[model samples]
Target: MYKEPIFLKPVFKDRIWGGTKLREEFGYDIPTETTGECWGISAHSHGPSEVINGPLKGKTLDQVWDKHRELFADQEGEDFPLLVKILDAKTDLSVQVHPDDSYAREVEGEAFGKTECWYVINCEPGAELVYGHHANSKLQFEQMVAENRWDELLRKVSIKPGDFVYVPNGTIHAIGAGTMILETQQSSDVTYRVYDYDRRDDAGNPRELHIEKSIEVAMIPHVDADFEPVLSGNEDLRMKKLVRENYFTVYHWNLAGSVSKIENPAYLLVSVLDGEGELKVEGETSSSFKKGDHFILPSTIKNFAMNGNARFIVSHPTI
Candidate 1:
């Protein structure tokens, strides 16, 4: 049976639009000044996380998933289904779209497609994101792209800390500059860039744009889904159900002292965003956790209790 929480070491990624907030705010030993993303609890091929604690120390999450299926409650999938990341956007990201599962399987040869949600960790005042497009039809979308009418076609929304947005596949979107967010998504990296705002790579060439593929996959008229968070808790701990969809379930948990609960899901992914805490598994073991710590509570741990004042973003795959 699982006793100790499996803590994972994050893998960092550098991006042209990245910044140093990951280092300054989260106290991470960032690799570069332009380090943009931290793959905190990921098992994706691009950046698999390494276990830093317990018996599984030094093994990658992907290795554990393949060898110790029971740790994940024997989830039926060839690859891990979920990926969690923290993004620090110093400049605007490329305007892009992603294909759904069917499209991704057929075209990209991937098992999952990205349907991501973002928790706004922090942002500058007047910060905005390119959430959707104004095009009413496929024809209009193509026309706008051809005519270079970005200002008229892109829909910008002002944002702040603590805001959350759900982005399903086929939705054209971009993270604007001066924003930091924690992103939870399916374990796929098939992005179809539609616009890059004339940005060039270090090689002095314009970034590639997938016009045909993007047009084939993008939604004709982007429609935002209404997701109302379910709030429930007691005097000690408060839980905010962020998104419960086909891909995954996410929540924000705030703990004041201590709370006890039975563990029933396949597994639990916990990321401490603020404060410190200690987790104890009944008749097993306990571990001290602090801000910026990320871990997994395996299904074998049937009951657990958390004590101390802390805030977290917790998630688990749906299938």
Candidate 2:
């Protein structure tokens, strides 16, 4: 069967500050919704169907979850797999951490934890994002929490285009502006916010903090900080690869009016980043293409090709 990219609606969490319909505003002004993914397509049940097109077509993310459930857990029942979203983080988000699988199942029953990464779309001057932190122990993190010195212990880094940040479960981090990103993560929204720039809600109320939980889950000596994308040759096919020992390996393929083929990775998600293109599957199967759309390559698609001047991000877990 043919599959295509689906654009879902983004349910916004209105803050004291937030753009009006980020998908319509920022996505039109800048690039797609590959930024912070707050009001972005949560992609699944908890996410919005912000954008759409292609074979996987009308299938809601929940439907896909039933099929790809094995990837998330072994039991007949399990937490949904990774949630993918395009984030247009117009401002700084909270510094938080997600519990690991063990902690999640134990503490937050019937829930799975989220470990994620941000594939930068566009970043502005003076932008910074959460990388890691200074504390080396959970007890120490708790102490910092007691004194509210979490920011002092965090490892903040300058943000720019073409950057990749992988945040595993238990790592404290946040997405800072100005940034747009493609986020992929375990399908759970159990985030423990440690800090949020003293910003209030529309009613001027401070957002409550999950201080104790954050202190318990924050990882020490966080090793997956300071991430960089791996650039491939340009000219005919310019590809940039971002790999983390996580649930996904995201890469951008910028190509001229030439054909290219990628083999091996069982299934494929082609999100057109620029221009138009056609994908040729193992059989005579082919699909139309456009920017900001997504399509899934048949798990049976042994081979495929690009037949136009285009650019897209191919995402999949690194087995």
Candidate 3:
């Protein structure tokens, strides 16, 4: 059994709404100037992360999940349950919605629905995004879209760095321009686009919109899903319980000194957001980590110790 942290190599994604900030801020060797996303900790078929260290080095995350099921405590899922990403939106994203589990399993034939949450990393001053709609019914929603009454239909909200937003399936939303976020999401990637600002590709073709499917999946009379994040920790280590949904639980770890004896029965997905640190398991040598590093603390590790100043976004599947 592997008892060390499984470090991962991130996979970059290019997007029309992307910019060079991913390279400028995180110092990533981005593939293009318009690199929009870093799939930091993912096992989705489209962009699975590769193991960069340990005996599993060179293996894709999906391969580990298949061959070494014990690494995850043998969690019961046909596919990896979570995906972690950092998205840099140079311009506004398409107004989109995702289907729930039942719809995804039946229609898209996917293992999971795309319910995701965002931790705002940085945003331009006075940044705002489309959160929901003011439509009272499906008919009214269709009417507003048909009329091109975007201002009246979309509900925008101001946002800033350090803010967190939970976007479940069927939530109509878009990431605004000049914004960056660390997103924790289900492994599925089924998005139904409602609007795209009439954008066109390099070939001069308008991007396709799933108007009917978007309408079918979007929540009528949008309801805000309320969450109460809890905080706990000692003086040197602070932990904020960001969200504990049916699929996964996420946390923000702020460390200044050291924490020994940290343990979790299940595996952990960890992404270092800032600063540097060293992690040491009971018998293994210490491993140094810094900003933009992502790794998995497998169940076989049992416990570990972390030292130094660092901030981390950590999550685990709900097994």
Candidate 2: stretches off by over 4 Å: 1-17, 20-43, 48-57, 64-80, 225-234, 244-246
Write candidate 1's Cα lDDT for 1-319 as tens digits.
Answer: 6678899999999999998999999999999999999999999999999999888999999999999999898998889899999999999999999999999999999998889999999999999999889999999999999999999999999999999999999999999999999999999989999999999999999999999999999988989977899999887889899999999999999999888874546699998888998888884587999999999999888778889999899999886
Give each model's whole-structure lDDT.
0.92, 0.64, 0.93
lDDT of 3 at 185: 96
Q: Candidate 1 — which pairs collide? A: none
Which pairs, if any, clash in model 3? none
Q: Give candidate 2's root-mean-square deviation (CA, Å).
A: 4.4
Model 1, residue 212: C-alpha shift (Å): 1.2
Write one digit per residue (lDDT tens) for candidate 2, span 1-319: 4332234434444443234334563343322333234433344455534334444446555665566543222224433355666666677788878998888889987366778877777777888988788877777767876787856787898977877677778787888866777777766778788888777775789987888787677777677656577887657778788764656677778878665666736555555656887766654656777666655554555566667887766776554
Q: Ranking under lDDT, best-scoring first?
A: 3, 1, 2
Worst 10 residues of 2 by lDDT: 70-79
Lowest summed lDDT across 10 adjacent residues in model 1 is found at 257-266
Going through the candidates in the order shown, the clash numbers are 0, 30, 0
| lDDT at 269, model 2 | 54
lDDT against true structure, model 3: 0.93
